[model samples]
Target: MELDFSNIKVVGFDADDTLWVNETYFREAEEKFAALLENYETKNKVDQELFKMEMNNLELYGYGIKGFMLSMIESAMELSNNNVPPETITEILNLGKEMITRPVELLQGVEEVLQKLARKYRLIVLTKGDLLDQERKLERSGLTRYFHHVEVLSDKKEENYKNLLDHLEIKTNEFLMIGNSLKSDVLPIMNIGAKAVHVPFHTTWAHEHIAPEEHDNSHLTLNTLSEILKYLE
Candidate 1:
């Protein structure tokens, strides 16, 4: 379907995968975590239980690596019947810290795309995460200069976008969102009468997956991150 973008004054980009490497690290950490707990449970079971732990803790912790580490620890203790070795817990903590300090690596063409769009429209980083961690990634990314506004939302739901549009004083039709997750990025923005583009990252957190029937026909998916330029330019 051909969608119009003539009135999109504010273009919102999801930071983690859309602009830089993120979920991939989480996946890596998860693999290491499962290996750490391999003695207590099968790797497959460890993976499954850890996901459940993370989902159950979402309300308490929101999104980001620290919460994930804590969940891993909790899962570890439970799997080992509270006999998990102390060194194992220490390893998990180190993993989380290493992730927090890892250098920000932007996706290919991120800078070029942001630079191109910023010249024509107001650009913003509208991502979900722990505020401090997200801000640190942005600071390291060096793409902060491209965005006119930056918002770190607790969650990307329909209401959140509605409130964001109100706070930015932007009409729904005048805003566009681009990100990697259909659940958190595309659908919510679409529900609010805004435009969005789906840019798939190689690895996706299972929670972000959604039924195809729930997606809006108006939303677009680009084959690659830089394809948005073809539509907007």
Candidate 2:
């Protein structure tokens, strides 16, 4: 879908996979965790158990480092007969902290595209993650100056998007959401009568990916963020 930026005011973006490298770090941490748990359970069993814990926690805690840390601790305790060493738990917690504080790596063309778009639109970052972690990444990326508003949300739902639009005093048709996750970024915005552009990332966490049936209307998918430039032109 072509976007005519002549009248568009606000452009919202997802932070993690949309602007920088995120999933790869999480995947690396998960592999290290699996290695640690291998002594107690088989790799496949550990993965399944961890997934189950994460799914359950999503309902209770939603998504973020807090939920992730809880899931890791719970999975370790469950798989190890409640005998997980304190030192090992400390190690995992340290690893999670490291993942959050690691240097930011902006995705290809992200800086360039953001720089270009900032000149024309009121850019806002709407990301869901641990508050401090998300803020740290934005500060480190040096892209914070390009955005007029930064929203670190607990979850990306239709109501959240609607509220953001209301708070900004922008109509649904005047806003466009750009991000990686179809389920979190695209579907919710589309559901509220806004336009969404999905910039597909190479790696996605299991929880981030969505089934095709969920994508219905007012959504466009692109392999690269740079493709947005062509449409806007």
Q: Pick the candidate with the highest TM-score.
A: 1
Where is model 1 more than 4 Å wrong at Cα?
none
C-alpha TM-score for every candidate? 0.98, 0.94
Worst 10 residues of 1 by lDDT: 210-219
Q: What's every prediction's RMSD, in angstroms?
A: 0.9, 1.6
Which candidate number has the best lDDT? 1
The TM-score of candidate 1 is: 0.98
Task: Quantify all predictions' global Cα lDDT against the true fold.
Answer: 0.91, 0.86
Instruction: Give the per-residue Cα lDDT of candidate 2 at 210.
Output: 72
Q: Write the per-residue lDDT of candidate 2 for residues 67-165, one digit (tens) a residue.
A: 787898899999999999998899889878888778999999998898898888889999998788888889999998999999988789999989878
lDDT score of residue 16 within candidate 1: 95
lDDT of 1 by residue, 1-233 (tens): 58899998889999999999999999899899988988889999999999999999999999998899899999999999999989999999999999999999999999999989999999988999899999999999999899989999999999998998898898899898999999999988887889999999988999998887876456788878889998887
